[model samples]
Target: MTAPVVSAADLPRALLVGVDFGGKAFFDPSLDELALLAESAGDLPVAKLTAKRRSVDAALFVGSGKADEIKALVQLHAAQCVIFDQPLGPAQQRNLEKHLGVEVLDRTMLILEIFAARARSHEGKLQVELAKLQYLSTRLVRRWSHLERQRGGVGLRGGPGETQIELDRRMIAERIKAVKERLVKVKRQRGTQRKARERSGVLRVSLVGYTNAGKSTLFNALVKAHVYAADQLFATLDTTTRQLYLEEARARVSLSDTVGFIRDLPHALVNAFQATLQEAMEADVLLHVVDAASPTWFEQVREVQRVLADIGAAEVPQILVFNKQDLMDESLQPRTDEDFFELEPGRSVPRLFVSAMTGYGLPRLRQAIADCREAEGDGLINGDAFTTQPYSESDDQPVIP
Candidate 1:
């Protein structure tokens, strides 16, 4: 369907495409999230197109017919680019770009672009560049015809059959290796810091959640530190940590705000951001923040869980912090401030409702963290009991207003 024209002259108009593979379970029917992603990447979505198929087309992904329809939409909307909700193969991407006569990007590229733009810290920028380079490496074939020309002359840089593409690929390979080496050093440095934290016997708590789920806001509230928090997707890329002193538990917790996760996060990004994500994996406790007001929160939860599992943080002790409680409808709001949420089969984690903006339920959330710290200190922390029995929904506990 045609999208209303946006008046922003600075934003490049884009056409969003989503293909519903009937058998795929991860299909986004409304393409609403894709539109949000486009906006996050500074693209103005002028139209949306969808197609249904049992499998992806070999050449254009959407096949020639749908490709033609998309071309029409692009012309109709005067779109400068077409973005697909699903990842496109290198060949498919190139072919689609050629046929549509506009830039074609898939979800992965769009996410990488956002990351490249949002990264502020030195480490964050390096990680983004590494991921982008890796992604570009695979699509180098025939990306530019000039790169296919042979370079062979007395004064030329290469011998008889060496082409520009080969030189470009070699340069990228060298850069990738260099970036990886630097990241290794950074990883080692982070390891040293984590070791120091461990020596202090302080609990490390990481805030992880779906993007724009108020994770940074909650972190700011808990630690009273100024972190860049906003309502936009992937607002902050750098991991910010601070010391949170709990008066009740008489403990100082190392609280860290991590980059938020999203559905279908690129593998290259996950690999590149390993140093940053290690905080969550090595945390003593994870605050899996959730936007209580979001209609698709359950799906968002599953996506975060999938990412957690990917990063080897699935078994980490997590306390579900349902943020933005003030935005929830009165009738739909949680009856209790603290409860247990079944994150997976036979696995229940402590859940608390809090509005970071309003400061409601923050005290009780602190109490929950203190309780976990106390349990850890007493050596009474049994994973099975901690997750399944003690705070199970079946337990009788007073519900806080």
Candidate 2:
């Protein structure tokens, strides 16, 4: 299917704002990632404002002076909306919108909107809706500014003598409950399928990494199935599972492509997509893909680790497949394909280099995966739990710039 193209002039002009607290390596100083996120959400970033603040202001977040500067930028660029790189409280969002005279969105809301737009499957749509509702449930005071709080008086469809905000909140609560119930059914269905897979004694492997890290590409290469591989952030939100046969190990494993992670991923989305993420959590092994060409690859690795930890998949045995190797400059490439992941005295997670786009060094990656599966599979039949090593506790190797 051909992708839809959006005109720049038709997209809303977004003014981006970020506050650097200092000492955070994951923080994007240029707000480039935020710009990508805005673009992914169909917004045109017209201007950017970055400030170094010691702490967040209780009301304006960026303090009054910075807020005024942001306001000027918004007006100067004719921005229709303002986006904050950091998450904002409901009151802080309201206060910022009132001060800037434009719609304001936090990082969480931006991600939710992208999910809402890109989600295709029923489970994906429901997960996004649930996250959006959970997020908006707290911001009703800001959402219903025009509607009076205490308007209902016995004849209203909502309830007798009920405030509009209260009625909406109640409705949102009921919806949240209903969506959660539906999700529980989905989870059980997945669980049953997993049990069936277990009965068949198949090895399970999941693809996981930072957004746009070529996970889908690697997945397509491994399984030979087209699962919507794209260059844009969050191109795949739904989990796609296929069977991958490893020739070297002579084993057929269930491979799943999961949603890519991002920096400061919203907790609500994490909670909402728990069922979808179950593939990663319960997989026999995880293929932790990474963009070998990114300058900030080390930081991206840390961000993906954080999400894995949040999803309780930190201990999953991972084979770090550095993808897009063909795009990496030779001068900056790893001195050797060998990398470290010390699991124990004798155990280590193999780090392999591969170009998913061109199929370079895929044989070594496949061999490494087949070996890992052979090792991990031995423990599976005994009803034993196995842990995936992520990193060394005292790993002090200098990050290759």
Candidate 3:
């Protein structure tokens, strides 16, 4: 295992817990993704435990026996915290912490923490703050219930004190409101830029896919820009746009590299980043990049589609770019570099193989984009549609062998 990104000296040792409800073949028994998430968030996962349960236990989540086991592990390893791969209700979270005698965090909070740390731009920061506030807002309940002895006003009902809870709620609400208002301005600014691009009549394209699927790498490869690209989750939290010139089309298109999606992305987080995600939703076309070398590419593809549908970008025309082609086994390579692959039943889209790293089959990817632009000009996507057609490379361009 790798050392924590933060100073390894005193990094929190975390115990990871994941539950399988059974009958779901997609369940990861090893909790590898959760481990990656914890590592990305600066936690050192000292131990991991997986369990099978038919239903959730409201108070303890994994039930008393499993929680005891978790507590034993925490004691054995001296883990500073317990991290759950599933969402924990407020009561469940509080109960887990009390039972395990350590801090308890769920998948949602782990992701939000990573977002908070990685966000750079003002808009990105504001979005993360809003998400954290919204997420924390839900968890304010019963947390201060222990303060019943300090209750204000009335018959000493001896209920959890409302004064502190109300004050905290008010504070979060005010901050959330302020952040939202600021984000509205950000959205307007983005809309203004979008309008300017619309006026220019250039074809718009946005790169979107699962996190760390090489969208940023491919974006740099195509546009020749220096946007940060890394081999980690949520590395790029903001939208970056650049002009890409296609020689064959004799035209340039507005290309944007947007943040990546992930499994079980919180609704509040998605809602908070609406301004950033809007770039993908309103684009003329989407470059749906995928990790071609991944054995679970189909599952990843389905997850991306699910997110697109959630954000109302499901109808956008997409070009599936199977990236990391250089890493695929020779036996797995398709005879043709470009063809139509069925993204779902009755829906086939243009799929191309290209190595964003080694530049393999890039000529075909560029030609495919040119085809989309020309097709749009021909009222094809807006009227009929663009399909996989033979790509002819421009005479002036050098092909990557």
Candidate 4:
């Protein structure tokens, strides 16, 4: 993982903890995600910890007793920051920091920081800033708590920045409104461009899936574009679209790779990035990328589905593209026959397994996309037709190939 872009003055030692909350029995992919977050924050995670709890403790997220244990570990490890895997309310976060005597941040803030840091384009930066403000607005009330205690140093007067928490929250709300206004204009311009593309009759295909599932790799391989591909989560924040042709159709297809999804993606982030994700919603076809070798592939699929449902993109026609098949054992059954049937029953959405590294199964994957285009052009129904009602709610479901 690349070192976080932190100034020397801001550099701090950190410890990352992934609280299982009785989920340790699962493969615990969030542990890897937290490690990446720690690296992106310019903190070296010298120690890592996990705990199982029935329910979150309101005051100290991991429970008061566990918070004390973490505090001791922080002291022993000389840690300056403690990163948590789940989203922590401002009060819970403040309580944890007070107990540990260190800075504390939840997964949402950590991701926002990374997005703010990685954003290079003007629009991308503005989107991230808007998201930060929206998230900050919700926490302003907690920032000024206990101000009546008269905790202060020299030159700290009762004026200027020492207003009540409610006042600060109102200011943040105003700022959030301003940011939304600016974003509205930005979203409008993006919509205009999308409309132009649609008028041109281009078949838009979006790469949608969990983070680090090799969307960019498959993108670069298929389109021959030099997009950065890394092992880190949320590596690609800005949406990149390229035009590609398959077979002799000479069809114009807008291929987009957007931000990846994760478990419990903050609601603030979902609302903030809705414009960006609208690209997926409006696409003619969606390439749902999956890491074939991951032990938690099924769970990752569910997580992505949850995000899609949250964003109202569940209705979009999706083609399952299981990537990184090269990492799977050769002895495993072929994806074309028994394995594919077992994984994707009834062909609810077209599914193909491919190894972006070895190029194995890619031909079939590409062929599937090509077939989808052909079928679409021929006025044949797709997964969209199954819109009568999804399998989850309906019994007489017809499968589409």
Per-residue alpha-carbon lDDT of model 1 for 14-84, expressed as tens digits? 99998889867588878888999999999998888888998889999988998999999999999999999
Candidate 4 residue-wise lDDT, 1-401, digit = tens: 99877564566777787776675334363487678777875667778888888888889989988898899899998999998887798899988888899999877888888888888777777778878878887776466666534324333334444455645666677777887888788889889989998899778889999988999999888888988888887788888899888864556578898889877677877888877898988887888898877767778898888888888887677777878877876755342510221223444664566878888777766666676676662221244322222233244322211
Tens digits of per-residue lDDT, candidate 2, 8-63, equal 99899999988888865346879988999999998999988888988889999999
- Give me the displacement of residue 279 in model 3, in angstroms: 0.5
Q: What's the TM for model 3? A: 0.89
Q: Which regions in candidate 1 have their CA more than 4 angstroms from the true location? A: 1-7, 154-157, 377-401
In order, candidate lDDTs are 0.87, 0.84, 0.85, 0.75
Candidate with top lDDT is: 1
- Give me the candidate number with maximum TM-score: 1
Mark the regions of model 3 whose C-alpha exceeds 4 Å error after superposition. Answer: 1-9, 24-26, 142-162, 377-401
Estimated TM-score for each candidate = 0.92, 0.90, 0.89, 0.82
lDDT of 3 by residue, 1-401 (tens): 99756576578999999999896645777888889899899889999999999999998999999999999999999999999999899999989988889999999999999999999999999999999999889888756656434555653332345566666677789899999999999999999999999999899999999988999999999999899999899999999999999997899999999999888889898999999999999988899999988777877899999999988998788888989988887778766677566666556677778999989978887877787887863332332333444333332221311
Clashes of 4: 0
Error of 1 at 150 (Å): 1.5
For candidate 2, the clash count comes to 3
Order of the predicted models by TM-score, top scorer first: 1, 2, 3, 4
Stretches > 4 Å off in candidate 2 = 1-5, 24-26, 155-159, 342-348, 377-401
As a whole number from 0 to 100, the lDDT of residue 154 in candidate 3 is: 53
